[model samples]
Target chain A: MITLSNLISRIPGGIAQGIIWGIMALGIYITFRVLKESDLTVDGSFATGGAAAVMMITSGISPWIAVICSFLIGILVGCVTGLIHTKMKIPAILSGILVQFGLYSVNLHIMGMVANVSCNPSKNNVFITMRSIPKAILVGIIFAAVLIAIMYWYFGTEQGCAIRATGNNERMAKAQGINVNNMKVIGFALGNGLVALAGALMAQYQGFSDVNMGRGAIVIGLAAIIIGEVLSEIIFPKGCQFFTRLIFVIIGGIVYYLIMIVVLWLRVDSNDLKLATAVIVMLSLAIPNLKKGE
Target chain B: MLRIENIKKTFNPRTINEKIALNGVDLVLNDGEFVTVIGSNGAGKSTLLNAIAGVWLVDEGKIFIDDVDVTKLPEDKRAKYIGRVFQDPMMGTAADMWIEENLALAHRRGLKRSLRQGISNSERETFKLLLKEFDLGLEDRLSTKVGLLSGGQRQALTLIMATLQRPKLLLLDEHTAALDPKTAAKVLDVTEKIVRKSQLTTFMVTHNMKDAIIHGDRLLMLNNGKIILDIKGEEKKKLTVESLLEKFEQASGEEFSNDAAILG
Candidate 1:
């Protein structure tokens, strides 16, 4: 059933999916690389974004407005996680997990208590749709480019640098009169906002949203980031510009999806996709440490 | 410039590892007065500095920095009036940031961070001039990540950063203890230069007896969470290691036993 030409035809779809997930990985990069906190909120917020966007689109709201709403909602979710950690003194990891656990019900409520929602692309002119691969890829590229530009500019500002410092060294940040708690809260918000935006785009592309759409999303995001970082190191051993790194993260996402396409072409069971991803990520993460040992 | 009234802190209170780090300690400092603290391992010299820096809330006491009660202020809030360098050089600056970026962070200490460029062109020039004065060659490496710098260089940079905003009080917690003697002396020289230039109120804790005797306008000896001895002015000026050791033994009613304090 699997053939080289068949695999080749599926490549564009994989690339489109990769770009969407790449945006999600950018969100993860904020907390994982910048704040140095692993937030599990993306798993839930991602689905929430899809749910919100699909519900809005079906309710006659424009796709752009729907995507923006999803981003704001994700930020609100992140703020809850942040406040729970900073104010309630819960550990960062636990706070993110708690909010994520609670978001399941919230996402269902947003989807009118349904487990899944869909927008008929035939009637609605979605910003991105898989019906036309070229259009979908073009829209994804534009979104990625604009988001990357904003991130590059924002992280160069005074407040942005403070956030970076907070992640780098909390004690030093506080010593420099930075409100580290506030910076962490801001990081979580911005990170999840981007994650939700990616979710909205994915929903539009797929024409449907499901409650479980974001299962294992964090691992996938990490895979993209790790792949991107490793590749970037190989391509630019001395390190590259921040803007270039951002672009590489998107490329990493595409590469990950392309690998999945290859695995599919090899006739691996679809249910084993998650297993393969875990192995790939584990190996990607281990390669650097292994090389260092040698 | 600084006042402490009956400040106390107990680590792991009521637990098997309970330690009274500070107990009913009180002190006052005039503006521009530099104070050096000396103590044995458990004498709470660093704890006293931490109390003033508001690293944690005191158990029962009021602290006044320039006559403003700040006993309840959190660490970051207190940072507006305080500058600190830790024993670890890495603690004072973000390692991943560029040399100039770290300076920019320090330059904006106690000021509201806005959407403005983190480091302006004029600010970069000012930083370059300042770094040039230190002669660390860091002036030429403004864009280099601070992690690439040597420990001594990092400490020197930290010293400059602490004084960048002209903090009301400077706290140096064994800042040079981890460096080699050569580097330690270099950092100490930088410290003295900055303190004398700005006349900033300063508190320095050191294990080296000679350093304690050589620096500061006044000296404090902490023993078992208490200030057992306080010497200043002409008395501090005339103090030698031998005489200071005798004074410590007399006040604490115990033999001076910390090897590093004696040998360092």
Candidate 2:
């Protein structure tokens, strides 16, 4: 049951899924690292994206347009969270949770009150699907590369630097005439937009979208980011370029998925994957603190 | 030029921890006037500066910078006309960003941020020339993170950032208070140089009496949410720590026995 070939065959699937999740991790990086806010809206926006994409694809819409729509929808969701946090004077974490909670009902509505929606590849002309794993991997890599390049260029812009400064130090940003609240709203919108894009890709790749597909997505994204940071430290002891950092985030996702494949191959209970993810995240987070202790 | 009229701010109104930070305070700063503010712990020196900076809305008052009322504007909006260097060097600049990037942000103050490159070659050259004036070897380390810089260097950089755009008004809130004596003097020296060079209207709050007297053209002493003494011109030049303490005691009707603490 635990044959090497069985595990080997799953590697491509693992890589494909990892790359999609890697895109999601990039979203998390914007909020968690750049904006310094742990936005929980991604968990729900992910499902919202999948559900929207599946429903559109099933109804004869172009899959590409469907994905783009999902991205825009995700941005609306993030704007709601941002407004709630800033204008309403609520805590950032609570605001994200509120949006995520509300998104469940909205996601269900998008899927026509159904828990799952599917677009059969045989009928629907989906752009990326599990039917051709190799093609999916190739497209995923291209998407990652293009996205990374855009991010590198965008973050080096004047408005982008303002967002970074807002995250780095709010008082300084404000004193420098940079609007801190507007920057935060923009950050949240951009972050969740990427998450929804990733969710749409995952939906198409698997040929189905489930309302619960985004459950525990934040932990996975965090896991990828932390793992990537560790790898970057090891490879470039001093520092690495921003582009390489982005690439390693995808590599980190790949490594995380490969490890999961091995765990599944070893006959670990499939239902225990969430527990495994928690362990991985907790260990990754604790390692730096433990090192500091020594 | 800056104007304040009957601005009053009270913290924790109706609560036991209530504090009357500023009470009906009014003052006008002329163009290129360098004013130093001094007080005890709760004399509302910072509260007054924050009011001018629009940190929070005053309960009752008006603030104007260059004849434009800014009492209703928030901190960021008012920042277009004002440059502030906080007591903590860390509060004035982003630590994770590079030295040049910090200067770039300061240079673009009051301007719209667009899709253009954050730091242009010409802007970088200007930043280098500015940093070189600090004589802290920061010009060569333009790419280095501000966090790695010493306290004095960071404070000096903050001063440069505050004056980069020649703001209508400059607010320095105990900016050099956290540095050592030599470093504090150095930063103050630089501050004097910049203010004089640009003729920028400036307000500096300091706990050290000597710095207050030595650096600015005018000095105001606050006590019990009021400006009890305003000394300037030849009289300010003739004042000393001992005489200033006497003035504080005469104005507030209280003994300032711990003059040494105030001198610091």
Q: Give the alpha-carbon lDDT of every model.
A: 0.93, 0.91
In the predicted model 1, the residue pairs found to clash are none
Poorly placed runs, candidate 1 (over 4 Å): A289-294
User: What are the clash counts of all predictions, listed in order?
Assistant: 0, 0
Q: Considering just chain B, what TM-score does every model have?
A: 0.99, 0.97
Per residue, candidate 1 scores C-alpha lDDT tens digits across A1-294 of 777899999999999999999999999999998999999999999999999999999989999999999999989988888889888999988999998899999989999999988887998869899999899999999999999999998889999999999999999999999999999999999999999899999999999999989888899999999999989999999998889999998999999989989988998898999998998888987887898996
Off by over 4 Å in 2: A290-294, B257-261
Interface RMSD of each: 0.6, 0.5
Every candidate's CA RMSD: 1.2, 1.3
DockQ of 2: 0.90
Candidate 1 chain A, which ten residues in sequence have the lowest lDDT sum? A116-125
Q: What's the TM for model 1?
A: 0.98
Worst 10 residues of 2 chain A by lDDT: A251-260
